[model samples]
Target: MHFLIIGGGFVGTALACELLKQAPAGSSITLANSGGPLGKGLAYGTQSPLHLLNVPAARMSWTDEQPDDFVNWLAGQGNTCDGAAFVPRQRYGDYLAVRLREHIAARPDVHWQQLQNRIDSLTPEAGRWIAQCAHGPALTADRVLLALGNFAPACPHPSLQALPADRYVGDPWQPDALSGLPADAPVALIGTGLTMLDLLISLQAMGHHGPVLAISRRGLLPKPHRENELPPPQWQAPAGWLAAGSLRSQLREVRQAIGRAQANGQDWRDVWVALRPRTTALWHRLDERARAQFLRHLLPFWDVHRHRAAPQALAVLRAAQAQGRVQAAAGRLLGARVDADGLVALQWRARGGQDTQEFKAARVFNCTGPSTRLAEGRRGLFGHLLHDGRLRPCPLGLGLEVGAGYALADAEGREQPGLFYVGPMLRSQHWEATAVPELRAHAKAAARAALGC
Candidate 1:
């Protein structure tokens, strides 16, 4: 059997390792990725020590049977990282690469190879999938996995288009995005999410003591993980909660569950931790309207609580805010234009006020998060797949729809043969799909399914 995995990031690389480990005799595994490194995707590619994994080392193991693989790896050598402590993401990237190399060496019977090219399209022929590469010849595979990760950030607001290249940085992940900024110059970040925190950390790492302003509609910062977590409560979700099909009922029940837990000397986070296993099932139960309501009304609250920051990382940010070096405001950006003083004049309206306000900064970085509309557009692989009627956008417009076993669901609601996907974009089907714990499961399942048991 032959398998092709596209998108060489964490999911892709992990899937390749899983395929190699579980492949039957005389199988071939090909990983196609034009991205920089094998396992260091955007999340782990950061060189900043301040960019730490949100989850603890113990929860980040990629292998199913070895949940302590990551923390144990950290224990090897003179390193003594605590299993419960959140560590640098760069270390996790190192872990992924090291594991991949080790797995490849251990699986000498499997014909393993990497194609350093972006797969442009997948066409099925004679029970095999032919992947067309950007700058290479087409390769046929018995199975193809789309591990396409996050795309470029969507424009935060319409006014962002007015900013000139010299004054604006669209993608914070760019190697030179933070370059050339004055140490003490005012810097405006367009979002108050985790990426904005990353920018702040990167700036601090570079000895930048600039006055940083992060603007968002609600100006919400990610909540920090508790210094000490209570044990996972044995409380069970109420009957019919997962099948309620009403967002209001589920929301109310979740809040009540957290309150009851708190009353019993447990933390609210314990409720969330306990609910992790059922999140996907609950998402499946909710209809389109309920899902939309959750996105429109509850997403922000869920994000701050569910996707929290490491305590150490948040402490630095809180200190910066207390020192007046960093500030966050609830405002809507009207647009930006180059002013007469050669600075970027960021025009915006405060959350509740009608009058427009202006703030001039030497540089601006867009950290509003990745674009979700690319799947609907006609530009790249997503578009080509949709145009070919092989892809269907989810009703919430968040990501592509996947059928059973992570198979690509066509526009006609049929599963595409020999094709599978396991990535953050699975958010459409599994609402809590982006993090390492969730994605790692999907990667292993998809790999095993592709191998036909």
Candidate 2:
């Protein structure tokens, strides 16, 4: 089998490596990615040393069997860190790139090829997939894996169109997004999530002395992980909670479970850590209505607890807040425009009030997080696929709808033969799919399925 994996981020790289590791002698693999160096993707492409990983070093191995590979590699780099330390995110990106290169070098028996080009479109012909690239010859493979990771964050407001790029930043990950930004200019950020945390830290490292205002609907921020993570506990969700069926009922049970754990002298985080293995199963148990209810009402609270920050990372923001250099407001953005004072003026309303509130800043950024909508504006490859009836989007607009064994299903609910996916977008089917532990397993499974193993 010739496997064609698009998007050489973590998943694509990992999947290709796994294929080389296990596939038959005749099997070959090809990876095509237009993004930065293969394996960096959006998450790990950061050059900032301050951007520490949220997951500890011990749990970030590329393969399950060699669990200590990453820690051992770190030691070789002259960095001494225990299992619990959150190392720089770039190191992991470097690890992935090196691992992919090393695996390819070791497996001369199987053909390994790479195309550092953007995939323009994909089509099926003669029971195989053909991928057209932006600037290369079309390639063919027996299997295709849509490892397209997270897309760029969607613009928060439609009202502010055609503004100066430097004044209004749409995507925070762009290398030049913060370039030319003034050191003491007031700034406004749209979301108070993980992205915002990274931005705050980045700004501080750049010697930005400006006051920053972050706006989110509920003003919710990710809770910081405990200084020393609690050891995993042997625990399980009660049978009653699983059978609760209703979102509200299950949420109540979860709250009660945490309360009970706290009362029993167990950290609430222990209960959360225990639930990591079961979140997907629990998500599947909910009907569409219940899932929608969870998205609308409980998602923010869930996010705060589920996606946490490194304590040291959060400390920077806290220090800024104490110095009155940072503030978070629970509000909704109504509009934005450049004012006479050469600043961006933002109008918003508090979470539960009718009165409008205005905040002005010299620079404004939309850190509203990645757009869950797989196809926005119907302009890109995903949108093109959707328009062609080759893609089925989840009803909740979270991501593409996939089928058994991670096959990509079309709008008509027909699974595309030999097409698979492994990435953050798996969140459409598995609520807890975005992190490392889940993705590594998915990559392995996708490799197996692609190879007909």
Candidate 3:
């Protein structure tokens, strides 16, 4: 058997390593990615030391069986850090790369290959999948896994279209996106999520002393991780709450749980942590309407609470806010244009205001998070798959639809055998799929399925 894994990010690398451990002798695996340090992806590729993992080192292992693997590895490198410490993301990336190399060295009987090229398309022919590369020879494999990580952030404000291309940045991950801008020039950012925090930290590291404006609908920032560990909550929702079968009821119950936990002198984070294990089951129980309502009304609030920032990073952001170097506003961008003086003019209305206000900045960045709608403006290999009717978007537009065993499903609800996916897109099926704790297991399961284990 031969396997082809695209998008050599953390997930792809983990999948390859798992296959190496489980596959039979003579089985081959090929991992392909556009040129970059494998396993880092955009999240861990940042050079700034300020970028820290939201998750603690203890829970971020390649596999669940060895929960302290990351911390053990850190200790081996002479870093005397505890399991609960939040370390730099680059360190984690280094760990992943080293783990991949170790697996490859230990399993010479299995053929391992790396292709540093982007896949342009995937065509099914002669009982195998043929992957066409953007700048290399095509390759065929018995199984293909689309491990594409997060997509680029979509431009949310239409007014940004009028601004000069040089003055507006649609993707913050691009190497040259921040180039040419003066350090002291005012800058505007679109979202107030983790991505926005990362950019702000990057700017601070670059010695940027200019005013920064961040605008979003609610302008809610992520909460900070707790400094001390609290006992995990043992409370469970009442059966009546679960039977309500509505998103509103579930939210009310969650709020009540937090209230109860607080009343008992327990941290609310403990309650949330206790609920994490059951999140997928609860999400699957919701009907389509209930799920849509949750997305529309509660997603932002849930995101900020569920996905928190490192305490150290959050302190920096709060310090910037206190110093007035950074400002966050709750509003929407009505429009933007380049002024006669080459400055960018932005017009926006507050959350509950009729009148629009204007602000000018030297540059603007779209950090509104990755686009979830899979079918809109499809590009590259994913676009080709959608165009060829091999893939279809989930009902909530979160990602592509998949069947049992991570098999890609088409619009007609037919699963495509020998084709799989293992990445953030699994969120459509499993709401709690993005973090390392969940993703590592997903990658392992997908690898087992691909290899017929």
Candidate 4:
């Protein structure tokens, strides 16, 4: 069997490793990426020492059976960290690269190759999937995995489009996006999430002392993980809460659980940890309207609590805010234009008010996170897939529609055989799919299913 894994990031690399362990002796695997080292992707590709993994070392292993693989590897490299330690993301990237190389060296019977190019299009032909790359010969495989990872940030607000290209940045992951900016020039960031935090840290490292502003609908920043490990909380769902089958009811139950935990002097985060295992199932139980309500009303609150920052990283961000180096506000961008003095003038309406205000900044960054709505201006290979009816958008528009065992589903709800996906986008089907623990399991399962096991 020959398997082609596109976008050789964390998901693709994990899937390849799983295939190596389970496929037949003569199986072949090809991992393709446009640039950067394998397995780094956007999240792990950062060179900044300030960029740290949100999760602790103990739970980052790619394989469940080897729970300590990452931490043990750290020790082998003369860096000792306990399972609870939050390490730099670059170290995790190095760990992934080393593990891939070692796996290839040990499995001499399996053919493994890496292609440093982008896949431009995919075509199904002759019972196999053919992937055409931008600068290489096409690859044909018995199966294909679309580990495309996160999408690039969408275009910024229409008003911001009038600004000079150099004055605005749409993608934060670009290596030089933050380079060459004036140290004293004011800057505005368009999102108040993890991406904004990353840019803030990078700017500080670059010695940028300019005033910074971050704007979002809610102005909510992610909470920090607890510094000390508490015993895992033991909690149970209220009787018949799941059976009630209402999103609002489920949320109320969760709030009640948190209240109970607080009353008992236990951290509310422990309740969230205890509830992790049931999140996907609970999401599936909701009807379409209830799902929509959750997204409209509760997603912001859930996101801040669920995807938290490392304690160290959060401390730095809070310190910056306390010192007035950074400012965050709840608002919506109205528009932007370059002024006579060469500064970009931004207009926005603060949340809960109708009046508009203006702010001048030398640079503006659109860090509003990845665009998940497939029907809205999707370009490149994914757009092609959707256009050709090979992939369907999820009902909630969070990502592509996927069926049982990670199979790609078409517009009419038919599963596309031999085509699979493993990424955070799987959140369309599994609400808790983005994190490492959930993603690693999906990779293993998808590989096993693809190999007919």
Of the two candidates 1 and 2, the one with more favorable lDDT, higher being better, is 2
Per-candidate local distance difference test: 0.84, 0.85, 0.86, 0.85
- Residues 1-453, model 1: lDDT tens digits: 999998888898889889988998799889888878888988898888779998888888877779989988888844677777888999999899899999999998989998888778888899998888889588999999999887788877666666777678888899999778889989999998888888888898888997888999888899988764424555666776546547787788888898897788767787787678888888888788888888898887888888888898888889899999998999998888788999988988989999998888999899888766545455767777888989878767678888778889999889987999899888988877789878888998898888888
Model 4: residue 439 alpha-carbon error in angstroms: 0.4
Put down candidate 2 lDDT per residue, 315-423, tens digits, no spaces: 9889999999998999988998888988888899999999998888887888888876865665656876888798888888678778878889998989899888888
Q: Which stretches of candidate 2 lie over 4 Å from their true place?
A: 234-241
Residue 71, candidate 2: alpha-carbon lDDT: 89
Among the numbered candidates, top lDDT falls to 3
Cα distance off (Å), candidate 3, residue 411:
2.5
Alpha carbon deviation, residue 173, candidate 1 (Å): 0.6
Clashing pairs in 3: none
Error of 2 at 174 (Å): 0.6
Model 2 TM-score relative to the real fold: 0.97
Candidate 3 TM-score versus the reference: 0.97
Candidate 4 structure quality by residue, lDDT tens digits, 1-453:
899999877898898888887778998999988869998888889898789898999989978989999999999999998888899999999998888888888788999999998888889998898898889689999999988877878766877766777899888788778777988889999998888888888888888988888999898998888885435665555656446546777787889889998898878888788778888988888778888998998898898899888888877778889999888999988889999999999888999999999889999998888867788766777887888898888778788778888899988879999999889888888888788999999999998889999
lDDT of 1: 0.84
Q: Stretches of candidate 1 above 4 Å error?
A: 229-245, 376-378
- What is the alpha-carbon lDDT of model 4 when measured against the actual structure? 0.85
